[model samples]
Target: MNDGTQVHLRLVRPDDKKLLEQGLARMSPESRYFRFFSAKDRLTHAELAYLTELDGENHLAIGAARYLEDGTELGLGIARFIRLRERPEVAEAAITVIDEAQGLGLGKLLLTMLVLAARERGITRFQCDFLARNKGMHTLIERIADDVRYGHESGVMQAEFALEGPEGLYRALAGVARKEGHVRPGSGLPKLETTNDS
Candidate 1:
């Protein structure tokens, strides 16, 4: 066994296929169920590829958390960014975490790291689309983001959090997005309900 504990956050390499599989296998069934909405014990090869892919337009960024000393793998957290082709200034964020690591603030860490990377790539806002049934996502969004918008029509709630300046300002700007869900955010955040938006 690799006994992965200490790890560095880095881009997933194509060579890390086995490591990725091992990490996913280590997740509790419940975590896997929530993260993937399935009870299956493993990720399909295609799914794994999609989860780790890092294309500029449609990319997957995984932050592998580990114990720093021994390079042992502790857990893996994922952040995915999708660019809006029609409106190049916009993008979206999707995330998932392994069960054992959910409450350890790794979600925030993964989100921060990914959002920063998105900013580096010129993405100003990070938005989410998750099952309304997932309260965890709602809590996560409400805590770190400005505010959340709930869509009653399809059970889809999308949260918008700015990735700029101070975290407080981000939240406040997010608050504006909450109100402006009916309007376009001055800089970049798109309307929440449009399928054309993303």
Candidate 2:
């Protein structure tokens, strides 16, 4: 985690489907299970379509990419929130980091980006589910979210958050801008692409 590598945060694009699949291929079985709750290795066509084509208003995603010196981009992790149809102010959240990027603060960075993006879209709450025995997930939830409520059912843990507390966040970040179907500067990635969501 401490390779002193710099990771750039960027919005996911429909064109980045190959990148997403490659990243998924690098994940371990345990990592896949932790994220999907299943041993699913590859994303289905529908799932890939769903993940890349985001509306930004209801479904938002941000990815962490490490730009290599050779100009290749390696996706380290991704975090996203999908707003509920019946409750637009609340969204279901999920995050996954590759084995190499697990504890290097990529997850936190991506989550903070999601928070900012969700805040801009009028989403005030987020909910996520994880395995009951995932201590890393518990620690992450405890670290960023202050008013988290947890419930357990059928050996799975569901955590909900109001998304406004834990005072000191990326207060210094000037923030990301979404305009004209494209993500503006300050997203860490300079070559961000746009999606045709309309």
Candidate 3:
């Protein structure tokens, strides 16, 4: 692919179920472990189905793609959001990218898109929790803000990224990631783009 093949972001569709499954299957063992916090790689089909019940107005999905001129999906990055019932001004975040597509800043790009969507939905803040062993997830979440909280007993790290108005979460994330040891996505990979397996 040439540099002109841009990565675009949009909402996920019902048709994306297969692509979502493929994205899960393509994950490296370590990536899967970090994503699901498993000792091994095994996601039940039911869980995958339960994961993609995307409803844009209530629950939101942000998708990343490199499309052909005809609009075929070449690669994908996805993030899910859950709007809080009691607190409509906040949303929870979960994100993923296919292994081969890593280091293109897809994670950063998807996250920034989600942040914007959250703001548009009247969300004033964003929150996410991930396993400590999921260093990439930790690093990516930490990218959004320096105010991160760790729960050692549960191995979960929580982050708060303010999403009020036009405050750019991506800009804040890029800034913090640079100063606070947030390795650029490429730094985690080998010479090839493959994810480092456990």
Candidate 4:
């Protein structure tokens, strides 16, 4: 069990479907809209199945889990990239953190891990879509990704960015605090920590 503030990052598993659902339930309606781009309150059976299934290379996902003293686990955040079949080198990335965990640097940490994971599988470009009002996310993308380009359509903002080489990624990781959390379930990327001051 963690000390409540500690978040354990690991590869997503099929069994995490329930935890993910619970995390969604805890989100505010606004938060839900921010992540899903709609007022979606529930995950359909098909949606759950799709979210839980991961192929590592094409549909890779990582979860940030917080454990209580009683051995209960809660899904604090998730970051994933799904490679397009038509463009194997490109992937769309998405991340969502529970409201309780927001502003604690969890989203940044998860995104950093996702970038490393995607680069490991030969993914070169990452795309993301969000509402134009979500300035926090925009700032985050600007901070981490290189060669970023933005597009706007009907109030929605889309960003595409290229992943940097190993040296840059390693430098970013090294700048973070190593004691905050650990990315696990096996990672080929450098093991640098991201600040998680929760």
Choose the strongest candidate by lDDT: 4
Q: What TM-scores do the predictions have?
A: 0.67, 0.85, 0.71, 0.86
Superposed Cα deviation of residue 20, candidate 3 (Å)? 0.8
The better candidate by TM-score, 1 or 3, is 3
Candidate numbers sorted by lDDT from highest down: 4, 2, 3, 1
Model 1 bad stretches (over 4 Å): 1-7, 56-58, 67-74, 152-154, 165-198
- Alpha carbon RMSD to native, model 2: 6.1
Q: For each candidate in turn, give its C-alpha RMSD to the true structure in angstroms.
A: 11.7, 6.1, 10.6, 4.7
Steric overlap count per candidate: 9, 0, 1, 0
Cα deviation of 38, candidate 1, in Å: 3.8
Predicted candidate 3 versus true structure: per-residue lDDT over 69-163, tens digit per residue: 79676546677789888878878888878777776666866676577666656777777877766677777766755555555546677776676
Estimate, for each residue in 1-198, the C-alpha lDDT of model 1 and write its tens digit: 023233334555455567668777878876665566557777778877766655644564645455535855454665567877775556777767777666766566456556655666677777687767777777776776664445543666667666656745434433432343312333122321123433
Q: Judging by TM-score, tell me the better candidate of 1 and 2.
A: 2
Ranking by TM-score: 4, 2, 3, 1
* lDDT: worst 10-residue window of model 2: 173-182
- What's the true lDDT of residue 93 in model 4? 94
Give lDDT tens digits, candidate 4, residues 1-198: 122477777778888889988999999998899899899889998999899887788998888877788988888988889998998899999989888888787788888878877776898899999899988789889878778999999989999998875656554563542444455324322433344433
Q: Give the TM-score of candidate 3.
A: 0.71
